[model samples]
Every structure is written in C-alpha cells, then in structure tokens.
Target: MSSAFDDFELKGHKLDNRFVVAPMTRTSADSKGKPTELMGDYYARFAEGGWPLIISEGVYTDRQASQGYVNQPGITDAPQTDAWKQVVERVHKHGAKFIMQLMHAGAQFQHNEYTDTPIAPSEVKPKGEPLALYGESDGWKPPKAMDESDFDAVMQGFVGSVNRAEEAGFDGVELHAANGYLLNEFLSEHFNQRGDQWGGDIGHRLKFVAMVAKACKDAAKGENFIVGIRLGQITVTDPDYQWPEGEDAMIKIVKALKEAGIDYIHTTDTDVSRKPFKGGSNKTLAEIVQEFSDIPLIVNGGIDESNYEHIAAHYPNALLALGKKALANPDMPKRLKDGETIEDLEFAMLQPTATLENEWQWRDEHDKHIEAD
Candidate 1:
C-alpha cells in the first residue's frame, strides 16, 4: 500500500507528497477583490509547513453575480490577476504548487460588489441560512434564472480566469463545482429546474460543467498546466440532500468529467469512508471515482493523522486533502512525518469570521506560534 507521505505526480507536476491544502474561503481580500499581502503570507505558511499542493479559496470568476462575500477575492480584472501573482510567488518560494479555485456563488451569496442579486441555474434559493462564519446575511434570497447571455458570460468568466491564472504563474486552476456554487448548482436538481440544454435530466445537467471543463482545458493547453474540479453531493448548507439518481448519477458525472478533459477529480463528503449516496451503495464516493476513472484523485473529509494511514492504504494512489486539520497545523505533513503532535482545530480560531486576520489574532491570543517569514 502506498503511504500518504509518498511522493506523487499529479498530471505532469511532481508533488512532494500526497497531502494537499484544500480550498478554503477566507473573505479577507481588499474590497476591490484583490488579494492582499496578508493572503500571500497565509498561503506561503502552508507550503513552508510542508504541504505539496494548495488549492486556493473560492475566487469569484466574474463581476456580475459571482462575488459571494463582502471582500471575496476575484480574478475578472488585471489588478486582481496581478495580486494573485504575488501569492503564486510566495507559494512557489516555499516549493509548493498552487491551483486557483474558480467559483461563482449561485444562491448562497451573502454580498456582491457589482450586483445586489444572485444568479443560479433556476430561480430557487438554498435550503439553509447563510453560514454565520462567512457572512451576516439574514437569509438566502431567490435567484434569477440564468438566461442564454448569462450562460455565455459564465463560460467567458471561467475561460478568462483560467487564462489569467496562467498569466499569473499559477500551476493550474480547479473549477469550483462543489459546495453549492454555480457549477454545482447546475449539477444539482434542487437548483436546476430548467427545461433547456443546461438542465432537465442528469445528462443535461452535466452538459454545462462539461463544457466549462473543456473550455478551461483549451485555455490551458500547454506548459504542463493542470485543470481539475471539486465535486460533492452535499451543499455547505444542505448536507442531507442527495442526488435523485444516487450512486449511478455520481458514476455518470465522473465519466462525463473525464471525457471533458478534467485532469483530476476531488471528491469531498462528510467522511472518506461513508457511503453518502442514496440507494444504499456499498462503495464510498471516493471508491466510485477510483473505479470509474484512471486520472489522479484527491479525497477530503474527516481525514486526520490517526486514520490517514488507513485511508491512504485504501486509496493507494490518491492525494489526501485536509481542511480543518490543516488549518490547526499548517505543517501537518512534516508533523506527521516527524511524529509531532498535530493540533486540533478549535472553532474559536474561526469564531468571528473565517478570515486570515482573525485566525492570526486568535493564534496570538492563544499563544499559537505562527512562523515568521
């Protein structure tokens, strides 16, 4: 069985180990959606701590309805792209590969600079309240159903973001199709009630995402640039919801993504071991991906040092992506390798908000040693 710490290669990029810093939302960018120097330091710390790959926070893809939070960073303009270049430099200085996660919040939006309204595949709203940790929106509002022009704009936003990521010196980009975002909304039956090519059945629902994947791949054609996606059945606010087609739907989704030239598939769930789909499938979602596709896989959810070895043994070739644990211990891989105690994440660190500045202040007050540059 392969160890989680074993060196691996994702696409053509050589990874130091199979541990990746999963994409996390840190609404700490400047009001103009430009990444700040603090954000650069925040990311570089993880790489210096020893994670091989880092998938960035959900970056807004367009100026329309994509801005999900008050200060969420975006990549629609040159200044934003230039700001990310500094972040990329910081990560590379620590010898880590960085992939920007492009996102368009569908209906889970709390605030947007350009528009007051949100947009989705259908006019539906998300099931639960806005995350208290992300923002202070009272409740979700009904969204405008995407039209033909909206579809074209969404496509261009993603394509343009990928091109900007390439120019900004990022290793690649991961389409944020998970966590109830625009692409995930398109995949979801709850949010996609359209009768057109963008929605209807499972096949139609997969069309837009597949098209986006192909467009991203086309934009990032050479230079060992990687294009991947994150997918899950559960939304941030609605965890109990399941796809109508269950395991069969997930299998079909994986097949479609592979055919669309997605270099990797990152699956997140409540746990890596749980069979989350309906109809009582024996296989976990990660297992289904391994069975259906030959590309690289990144598995997240409830992974820690205690069970990571076992999880690694199960998915021998897959990378182990961690969020909560990584937050508590940025040097998680090195800590595990050296038999050091890995810190557990206290909700206090992210209490007021999930921003970089808040985390730093919490660490200071709690005497948590943050490494200096």
Candidate 2:
C-alpha cells in the first residue's frame, strides 16, 4: 500500500507528502493577536521536521466576538497579516504549504470574557458551561440570536478575513465550519431555529456555508488559492447531535460545497476509523464525501501510524490529516513512508498550555543531554 509519504497533487499544488498537519489551537500568540516568535519557531520546527502541509491553528476573523480563546491568533488587521506573512514564509521555506484556518467562534464564546452576548444564527445556548482560558472560571451565558443585520455583518467579517489571509501570503484558507462553531450552529437544527433563509431545513441551513464560500471566492478574485472546509461528524457541545435525516443532509451539503467550487473537503471524526455519519457503519465520511463531492477529500481524527497502512489500502486517494500524532512526532510522515513502525510515537497532550509545557520540558532535557555529551 502507498504510505503517508506518497506525494500527491491537491488543488493544483504538488504536496510533497499526503500527511497533513491538522490545525490544533496553541493559543501561543501575543496579546495583539499576532503570532509570536516562539509560535513561529514552534510551527517552523514541524515544517522542518517533515510535515508537508501544515494547517495553522484557527485564526479569528474580524469580529470581536469571534475571539474564542485568549491569545489565539487572529488575521484581522494589518499587523496580524504581516505576522502571518512571516509564518507563511517560514513554513514555505521549510518546504511546507501553510493554510490559514479562518474561524469565527460564534456563540461558543464565554460572554464574561470577550463580549456580553455572543451572536449565533439563533439565540440558542450551547450544551455545557463555557470554560475560561487556563485558570479563569467565569461560567456560561446564553448567546444572542443573530438578526439579519448581524448575519450580514458576519458574512462581511468572513470576507474581510479571507482578503487578509490572502494578503498574509497564506497558500490557501480553510473555513472552520465544524466543532459547533458558527457554521455548525447553522447546520444543526437544534441551534438554528431561525425562520429566515439562513435557517430552517437543510437547504436553508446550508446557506451560511454557501455564502461564506462565495464571499471567500470573491475576495480572493481568481487566485488559485485552495479553499477547504473542515466538517465534523458531531460537534463538541452536542455529542448526541445526530440527525434523523441521516446521511441525506450530509450528502446534500457535500453536493452544495462541490457546486460552490470549494477546492477540497476536510472531514473530521472522533476516530478516523469510525463512520462520520450517524449510522455506526464502517463507511468513513471521506468515502461518503468522495461519493458526493467531485473535489479532493482529506480525513482527520484518531489517525496513527498503526492504521496508516489500512487507511491507505482502503482509501487510496484520500489524504490523511494527523493532529496529535503530528504534534508528537513532526517527522511522522517520513517515518511512516520509510516503513518504520511508529507505535511508540508520543501522543499529544490536551490543551495548549500542556503542549507548550511538554515541548519546553523536552527541549530543556535535550539541551542538558547535549551539554553532558
């Protein structure tokens, strides 16, 4: 079977390898919402270590309420764009393609922290209480339902972000549509109770995504910028948020995305091996998306070296996106391609601080060992 190191052409870009570094929030940016030198060093290390495609952490759009976490990177203004330009240049120099995952936190915001009320398609509260960044403990508050004006503003915000991303020298942009964010909120009937064109049934529910896609395409003009969407089987807030409409809703959405001219579709599941649809079948979401979409498809979640061969054998054209695995072993793609076993590859720890702490500790220990030598 072809390994993760196999080179493939995705959206006209010749990716050196099929293993993509999935976007994981580091919250390592400075207070100005610009990436810091340390953050740049961290991502550059991964690129240098051999990940072919590195999808940067979720970057907040222009909306103030879109700031999901403290110290999360933003691509809102000129300085942020300049900072991202540096990041893109570094990653490209290291022979890796960088895509900015543009995201709006939507109603998933902690009202106590950023704004008094988070705006969503509907005035629906998310499942659980919101946690503050790190040690802060202010709880959750119900979000405000977005009116027509708010919706228009959000669309404009996304468009502005896309323009900024292109200006920042990113190779492409991935719309963060998954994880119970704004797009997902619109998709879920529970969250989206609007009677307008932006809500209601599946067709209307998908309008937000369609609008965003069109806006992004318009902002980029005719640039060959890759536009991808990251969609999940279930959202974080609603683990039980399965649709009674089954794969039909998902199929319809994929068809719509394909029609929208998106370059690729990135599907996420709790486990890559698990089916993305509500049914507990072995048919993965990538397979289903491929059936519906004419564009390329990338699959992420619970991917490791052990399952690489199996996945490759089964899904030939599918690109595997590795999150925790990439974090733990930056050279994992090379290792897998070399036919080396990666059962012992370190698993990534949860939360940004923990990841930073572990990386720092390991660096210190390695430095001391080098000194001893």
Candidate 3:
C-alpha cells in the first residue's frame, strides 16, 4: 500500500514527502500588500509541522490593480519583495520549500485603491460583485476589456513578479490561473466573449496563458526556480463551467506548458472526485492530465488520510495537497508521520478575515460562533 509519506522529486527539487500545503486566502497583509511578520510565522509553522511544499495564498503581481481584496499581498516592488524574504527564510529554516502564487483578480476585484476599472480579457460584466470583507466595499465594479497593452501587462507582470519571487528566495512561483480570476476569465467561454486572437476557441484562449508561461519560464533564468500553474476542473463562476474546447483541452494546454519548459502542474476542485467534462479516457481528471507530462502533478481539495490512502493506492505518482485539513491542524503532516489520524473538518474554524493579531486565535473563536449557529 503506497502511503502519502513517500518521497518525490521534480525538476531537481527533492521533496521531503508528498504533503503539499495548499494555499488559502487569509486577509492579513497590510494595506500595501506586504505580508506581516505574523504571516511569516504562520507559514513557517506549516514547515515546522512537516509539510514539504507550502504554496502561499494568492499574491497580486501589480501594485494597486492586481488585488481581489484590500489585504491581499503583492510582489511587484521592492518593499513587497523585500518583505517576502522573511517568509522564505522562515520556511527554508524548517527544511521545507516555499512557492509564491501570483494572482490577478481582474473583474472580481473588490477594493477601492485604484481609480481605473479592473482589466479582463473581455468586457463581460461579472455576474456578482465579490463580497466585501469587514466593512470595505467601494471597489466593486466591472472590468475594462483588455487591449494589447493589457495583455502585455498580463505577460510582463507575471514575468516581473516571478523574477521578484526568485529574488526573494522562494523556491518557485505558481501562477493562480484558477477560481475565475484573470487567467481563468480568459480560459473560460462563459466569462470571455471576445472575437480577437486572445479569445474565441481553446487555442486562442490559451494564447495568454502560454505567453505568461514563457515569461515566467524566461524569468526563472538562473537557479532551479520552479515555475508552475494552478488550475481547476471548473471555473468558479459556475460549478458546471468547463473549458470551451471540452475536456481534452487541458491535455493540449499541458503539452504547451511542457513545451514552454514548465516544471509542474497543480490541480484542485470542490472535490477532486468530480467528473468535470467530456474527455478522452475514462480515468480521473488527474490521471488523464498526468498522462500528458512527466512533470510533477499535484491534486488538492478535501485531502485527508483516507482520501490520500485511496488516491495513493491508485495514482501513486500524484502529490497530495491539504487545505482545510492543514488549517484545522497545522501539525497534520507530522501527526500523520507519527502514525496519527486527521481530525474531523470544522469549516467554521476558518476566519473570513484574518489579521496578524487575530489569526492565531481566530479559528477557536470563530468555531464557537459558527458552530453555535
């Protein structure tokens, strides 16, 4: 029986084990998108607890407009880059690898910092405004249809950000192309309704994604800078949403990423067991996608001991990512290593908004409030 404790290697980076700490949004950064010191301690805790790779919460690439919420972190400038070094050092201190996840909210942005409208691949108005965090709500608005310059920024911003990440001492960078964000907007037919070269069919939809991949890959010039993308089976806009080109589209996308010299691909969904779209083989989505490349593959969402055991029994090559389970117990990986079991998931334990001062105890307090409801 294959277990989640097995070692794995990808692109010359040797992981301690298959436990991947999946990213989770914690509204704890300062106004300028620099992670607070407490955030560093938060991440280091995971490493201390024994996770192999810690993929951070989405960090915007642009200074002002790249945010989905007011408190999200950014890596576009010196202060932000300099600030992340502490996080990297802390994670590495505990013998775990760290990766920065670059994300652009596009039309889903819900902050008032920037005066210009958000940018997207098309002018299609987002169906619902992103819910406000705390009391902030003035930035909710539709996005501007991206022009050539916008696409250039999409490519260049990612390039610059990943370079910043590399400079900050992160082991790698993961592009957040999932969850109906800017990248997914371009990739989904339900969100993007443009007729230009950047949209329409699956090939065209992938153009921007491919451009970003090349830029990120190029920016990873020296060092074993790992560059990968996190994608999902369905768009966040709708549970039923899928690639416009059908299920096999990801196979093509994977080939393109491999050709671009990407190091890995990460996948997730509401449940990893969901059969998202019509595809070639009857294998699980992760199985079919992994068949496309020898690059390391990561599958996340609802992963616990039982899920990991089942998946490991079948797809022994896939890495398991733990999200809520990790949150419920930061020492989860270590516990499993010690021959313990995962605790029951407590969804109410997550804080809708977290701050450095409060994040440490937010779960306990919130669990009291939500569980009572």
Candidate 4:
C-alpha cells in the first residue's frame, strides 16, 4: 500500500509526495500584476506546511486584453518575473516544486479597459458576463473576433510567457487550457466558429494549444522543466459544462499534447465520484481520460481529507489537488500524513468573493453567528 506522502516522479522531476496545492487565485498581487511580499508569505505557508507541488494562480501571458481580472499576476515582464522568483525560492527552500499556470482570458474580458478588444477564435459573445478587470459592475460587452495576425500574436505571447516563467525559476509550466479561458473557448464549438485552421473540427480547434505546448518544450531546452496542460469539462460560462462530443474530443486533444512532448495532463472535474455520462456507468472523468492517454494525471476539484485515502487507493497514479480545503487548512496534507483528526476543517475560508484579509474575518463572524449547539 502506497501512502499519500510516498515519493513520486512527474514530468521528470521527483516530488516529495503526490499531493499538490492546486492553483487558486487569491488576487493578492500588486496593481501591476506583480507578486508582492504578501504573496510570497502566502505561498511559503503552504510549502512549509507540506505541499509537494504548488501550481501558482492563473498568470496572464503578454496580451494586455488577456488579463481577465484586476491584480491577477502576469509573467510577461521582467519585474513580474523577478517578483515570482522570490515565490519560487521560498517554495524550494521548504522542499517543494513550483509550477506557473500560463493563461489568457480571451473572450472572457468585458470592457476595453485592458485593451480595445479581447481576442477570440470567432466573433461570438461569451455566454455570461465576466467581471471587469477593475470595477464592480455587471454588464460586459462582447469581444471582437481575431484576425490571422492577432491569432499569431496571442500564440507568441503564450510562448513568451513560458520563457519568462523559466527565467523566474519555476519547476515547470501548466497551460491554463482548462477553465473557460482562451484555450477552452477554442476547444468548444459554441464559442469557436471560425473557418480557419484554428477552427472547424476537433483537430483544427486543438491547434492553438498544441502550438503553445510545443513552444514551451522548445523554450526549455536543457532545464528539464516539466511541461503540462490542464484540461477540464467545466468553464465559467458552462458551469454544468460537459464536452458534447464526449471523450472523443478529449482523446484527440490529449493525443496532440502527447505528440507535442507535454509531460503531464491535469484534468479538472467538479466532482470526481460522478460519472461523466448520463446512464452509462463507467469510470470517473479523470479515470476515463487517463485511460485514453499515457501521461501522468492530476485530479482536482471536490477532494477532501475524508476521501484522500479512498482516492489514492482507487487512482494510484493520479495526484489529488485540494482547493478550498487547502485554503482553509494549510496543514491539510501534513495532518493527513500524521494521521490526525480533521473534523475541524475550516469551510468558510473557501468563499469565492472574500479577500485574504477578510477571509478569516468572515469565517470568525460566521462561527460566532452559529454556535456549536
């Protein structure tokens, strides 16, 4: 029987354990999208507490319009890279590997505040309104479709961001291909209706991601940096999201990434126990997807201490990513490893709208409002 703390190798780097601190956007960075001292402290806490692999929050590439939220970190500039280096150093000092998630918001952006237009594969409007980068309003306008030149520029931006991540001392990079970001928009038929090489069939739709992965691998020549891509069935717009084409699209995309030399596949599903299809009783989404491909898989979303043993036993090769649980209890992995009772796990710390300063405050207030009795 293998323990959660057992040593594991992923994408060429040896990890102290199979537990990874999945990427969660705290929005604690400085105004310039640079990591601050507070950010360093925040990440260092997790490393010291005992997370073997820490995937940083989704970071913008180079395109200004790609910035989806205010204060979200960016890896495109030198100062930003320098800021992230401090985070990497702190995580490494505590015996953990850090990976940066390179992302582009694409059609998710609302106004021209970041840029005149948010680029997308087609001129289709996003299903719902996403928050503006700077304000607290609701109505967001649709983005203009991208031309051939614009598409190439975005690809270059992704490539450039990966190079900067390497310079920042990250152990590897995870393309933010999962969430309803640029890559997800391209993958979905409802969003990407282009008639070019980047649209039409599944193969064409997967071109951009493949190009980005290849660029990252080529950029990190001798560094042996682990390159991975995060793919999922959910997007912000399509919350109850499912790939209508079933696993066929996923299989094709994974095959392309494998050919591009990507080392791992990070699959995100809101609930791991739920079957992917309606009536067909089959393996979970993560299991089914992993079966189709031959790369290491990191299963995230809906993981808790109670299910850690069961998950580890069932999916031996998959790494479990704890989001809200990890945020509430930074020592979760450590507690599990020590076989300590975890019934007091903080639940309110996972509030999506609460800030770091207000998270604990809100939790305290809520606790006071609700007595143990």
Candidate 5:
C-alpha cells in the first residue's frame, strides 16, 4: 500500500519524501559571506536525519545590495560558491537533494554595508523599525527608487546566482520573493508605487519577478536543475497589511509563477490552514494555491503534527515544510513515521545552534569565564 512516505517527483527528481526542511536564516557566516564548517554540518544533519529535500537559508544574490543581515551567506562570488560545494557534497552523500534560496533583502538591509543606497521597486519605508536580532536595526530604511539600470543589474544578479548554484553542485534554486524582501516589497501597495511597466496592477507588479524567474529557468535549461519560487501573503515588516488587491491578486500571482516555468510554489504566510478572508471558496490558503496552480505548493507556517494531516489533505501534491520544528528535531519525519508527538520547544533553543537548553546556556557562561581569564 502506498503511504504519505511514498516518493513524489519534483522538478525532474523523484523526491524521497514530502517532508522538507524549510529555509531559515542562520546569521553565522563570515563577513565576507563564506559558509562555515558549522553551516555544512548543520544542514547535513537534516539530510542524514532523513529529509528528502532541503531548502537552504536565504542566500544573497547581489553581493552587497542584497544582504539583509550580517554573517548570512552570499552566492555572488567564487568563495561563496566554493563554500556551498561542501554542503552539497554532504547532503548528496546522505541521498538527499538541496536547493539554494536566492534572495535580495532590498530596503530591509544595511545601507552602510553597500555604501550605495539599497534599491527597491519604489522608494518607501518599511512598516516597522528593524530588530536587534538581525544585527542592526538601522538597516531598515527607505530604499532608493530603482531605475532601469538597477533593474538590469538586479535581474543579472538573480540569474548569476542560479548559474553559480548549479556550478556549486546544488540540485536546484528557489527565489525568495516573500517575507517583505525586494520581491515582496514590489508586491505590496504601501511599498511599490511605481507607475511604469514594473508596477500598477497585480500582473504588472509581478513582471520583474517573472523576468528573474524566466531568466533563471532559461539558464538552467537542459541541466539537472530545478527552479522554484516562494510566495507570502503578508510582509514581515507589516503583518496587518494585505496585498494591494487581496485574494484575486494573490491567485493571479500564483498563475504567473506557474507560467514562468516554476516547478513549485512554496508559500510562507499567516498560516496555511487559515480560512479565506473574503473569497468565494471556503477552502484554506493551501487549497487556494492548489486551486490556482497545477504544480506542487509547499505549505509552511503553523504546520505541526496537530494540523499537518488536515492541511496536507487539501493538496494532492503538498509538501510539508518544517521550520522551527525541524531546527529542534532533525528526525521529525522519523517521529512521524513512528507516530511520536512533536515537541513544544522554546524559541531560545532553535537559534544559532539548535542544541539542548542547558548546554547552550552553559556555553555562554563558559565563554564569559574565558573572557575574564
């Protein structure tokens, strides 16, 4: 009998299972943006622990301009590419596939790092002030309005990252168009006020994103490469905000992504299980996405043992991506396979290193002692 554990094909590869490690930022790389030994070991454990596919943390594609936080990895240069090779090799050794998430933080990043002002679809400030956890709060500023020249450069940067990811041995790439980053900024009405070809209605707003997706897809042609995109309902900067045109715009965006040849659409939002606010369908967000696209929709956020079964039932090809839960337990799927209950973890336990609470706390005290000595 076929089970939920049965293999499913995604982007030319038969994924070993529907369980995926959702992309989460770990700001632990060097300033120059090289992945550390710890980073490789960190990801390989999830693969070794049995996840079929892993979406890596958001990796900046435009070197300086795209960086959102300090110590996060970059994919714009040879060193960054070379560093990722170690990660790919380790994941492949465990029989799991890896995909790099290409991102540009846009106005949500540091202005000091780039010296030049950060570029966005339009000049607008983010909704809230930045957080200290991201290393610098002042990084969140109104971005300079992007011109035709900046658009050309940004497009090339995304396409370059895809080429570099393939060269670095990754099986695929996912564009981070969600979470109020550059792409998400364009999708929001409060941010993108441009009246040009790149902005206006739902379709026009998605034009630049489509360009990047198509360029990356074209670059990966004939290669054993998978190209996908991630979408979000609300911006990280403004949770209360809705899309400029609401559900219709969202439905249109999904269709546009599918037409651009994206193999899958990974959605990060309020919750996959939440009911529609003002839609004709009584179905949840996951069902709505499935309704709009023929491809797989990776539903994330608020997915745990409690609701995963019900949420997964909405889409025939839904991939359940675990974020905080995955950080706490690499063997999440194994537990599910054995029918074990998921843990309720403290937020402090899932960052920097997802180790035991006492161990992490002890290490901090030890470091202070060493400093005094």
Candidate 6:
C-alpha cells in the first residue's frame, strides 16, 4: 500500500511525494509571449508549498496558431525560451521538478498572434463556446484542415518546444493532448472528421499524437528527459462527449501511447472515479490505463482533501494531481501532512479573468473587506 506522503519515482526523477501540482491555464504571461516575473512566482509558490512536481499551464509551441488566449506564454523564439529559465530556476530552488505543458489551441481558439485561423485534423468547430475564464468569444471558430505541411509544422513545433524546454532547464515536457486542444482535437471524433489516414479509427486518430510523442522523445537532449501526455475524453466545455469506441478504444489508445514512447500518462476527467465508458464498463479511465500499461500514472480531476485518501488507496502507485484543491491551498501537501484545515477554492479568486496579478489583487481586497467587518 502507498500513501500520498510516500516518495515516488517517475522515469528517472525521484519525487518527494505522490502529490503533484496539476497544470492550469492562468493566461498570465506578457503580451509578447514571454514568461513574466510574476509567472515565475506563481509557479514557485507551489513548489515552495511542498509539491514535488509542478506541471505548468499550456504553453503554445509555435508562433503559428498555437496560442489560444491573449497573453499566453510561448516557446517559439530565443527570448521566450530564455525568459522561462527564471521560472525553472525558481521552482528548482524549492527542490521541485517542473514540466512544461506544450499545447496547440486548434478550433478551441479564441485568439492567436500569428494567425487568425486555427488548424485541426478537420475543419470542425468545437462543440461549445470558448471558455470565459481564458478569453472572451461568442463561439469557437472552425479550424482549417491540416495538410502535409501543417502536419510537419505541428511536429516541428512540439519538437522545437521540447528542445526549448530543455534549454530552459525543465525536467520534462507534457504534450497537451487533452482538454480538446490541438492534439486532443485530433483524438475527438467530433472535432476530427477527416476521412484520411489521420482519422477514421482509434489507431488512425491516435497516429498524429503518437508521431508527436515519438518526435518529442527523439528530440529530448537528455536520456533522462521525461516526455509525458495528458489524455481525456472530455474537454473543458464539453463534458458529455465520450469515445464512440468506449473502453476498448481507451485500452487501445493507452497501448498506442505506450508504444509511442510516452514516459507517463496523466488521465483527467470531471471525476477520476467516474465510469464514463458509454459502453457501460465499470472501470474508470485511470483504472483502464493501470490495467493496460506499466507506465507511471498521474491521475487528476476532483481530487481534494476529503477524497484524496480514498483515491490514493485505490491507485496505490499513482500520483494524485490536484488542480482546484491546489488553487485553494498552494501548501496543500504541507497542510495535509500537518493535518491543518485546507480552505476551499472560491470562484471569486478567478473572477473576470484568471491571472496571477488578478488573483493577488483579489486576495488583497478580500482580506481587507474581511478585516473591515
């Protein structure tokens, strides 16, 4: 049996505990796509709070259509890559490993500096309107169908970003293939309607993601450089969507990712324990992954102080990645270990927009209001 406080190892990186800070999009970077000083502090806060591993928010990989929101961080140019060094340095000082999550917006796009159009496996729009938390948009725009050149560019973007991540001194890179982003758009049958080899069946749909993963692994400058991916059937806005192929499809997807040299798999959903298989399977997505592969597992979604112990007991070998709970308490690991009362996350902290500066300002005002009473 494994507890959350126990040390764990993923690839060659030895984690201090099974607790991880999940990647969250704060949309808190400079207008030029450089990581700001504030962003460094925002990430370092988690490491200082006792999280062993911190996965950064989705970072655009290319200057062409990869950016999904205004002020989103990018890793395309030298200066942007150089700016990330400070962020990595800050986290490393706390003895925590940081992994940059590389993403392409696809049709879920709200804004992009390089191009007005989003690119995807097909010219499909996302099922729901763009998220108000990230950016404002009436609805999702239909993406341009990707061609051979587009495919090459997407691959190059991921590989180049992985190299930049190495240059920035990151421990690893997680391909943002979940949450209906570009890679995930390819995975979703609703978004990926292409009749070509890149679409149709589970294997074909997974081909692009596999190729990107292999390219990232091959491009890693260090043998110990970790390359992982976040996978989910549901997007941020569209929750009801599941694979038409269901549990078997998920099994094959896990098998394919393992074959593609993915170092680990992070399964996220609205709830990690939910049986979302439309075919009526009793297993959760994380369980399916555990049953199929021996790779390191990081499970996310609705993992909070109340249910963490039970969740940990079930996925004994897996790392529990916390998003909302971590936002509520950056020092969750320390607090949990100390048996301190952890506060719940209030939506007011992210009111109007989700940004590091905004959160700080909100806290100041909130604390002041409390004192005034």
Number of the top-ranking candidate, with lDDT as the measure:
1
Of models 1 and 3, which has the larger lDDT?
1
* TM-score computed on alpha carbons, candidate 3: 0.91
Tens digit per residue, CA lDDT, model 2, 1-373: 7766678887778887788889887776777788977677777877876777889888888645787777778888899889888778878887788889988888777422346678888888778766533324366557788876777777887888888888888888999988888888888888899998887788889888977887787687535788888986477667567655568778888888887888888988787777655666456667778776667878887878678667766667778888878766666766666766564433333333434545556657545111100
Q: 46-155 in candidate 3: lDDT tens per residue?
A: 88888888999988887545777767888888999999998899889888899899998887777635545788877765665455433256634767888877777767
Write the candidate numbers in order of decreasing lDDT: 1, 6, 5, 3, 4, 2
Clashing pairs in 6: none
TM-score of each: 0.98, 0.90, 0.91, 0.90, 0.90, 0.97
Worst 10 residues of 6 by lDDT: 364-373
Per-residue lDDT tens digits for candidate 5, residues 212-316, read 888889988445689988887567767666665667877888778778888888887677766543444455556667787787778888777777766666566
Minimum summed lDDT over a 10-residue window in model 1 is located at 364-373
Task: Name the regions of candidate 6 deviating beyond 4 angstroms.
Answer: 368-373
Better of 3 and 6 by TM-score: 6
Write the number of the candidate with greater lDDT, choosing between 1 and 4. Answer: 1
Q: Which stretches of candidate 1 lie above 4 Å from their native place?
A: none
| Clash tally, candidates in order | 0, 0, 0, 0, 0, 0
Off by over 4 Å in 5: 1-3, 276-283, 350-373
Better of 1 and 3 by TM-score: 1
Which prediction has the highest TM-score against the true structure?
A: 1
Cα deviation at 254, candidate 4, in Å, is 1.3
lDDT of 4: 0.76
Per-residue alpha-carbon lDDT of candidate 1 for residues 1-373, written as tens digits (9 for 90 to 100): 7888788998778888899999999899999999999999899999999999999999999889888987899999999999999999999998999999999998888999999889899999999789889868878878999988888888999999999998999999999888888999988999999998888888999899999999999899566999999999889999887888889989989999889889899999888898998888898888998998896899999999899989888998699999999999998998998999998999899978898889999989989967735
Which one wins by lDDT: 1 or 2?
1
Candidate 6 lands at a TM-score of 0.97
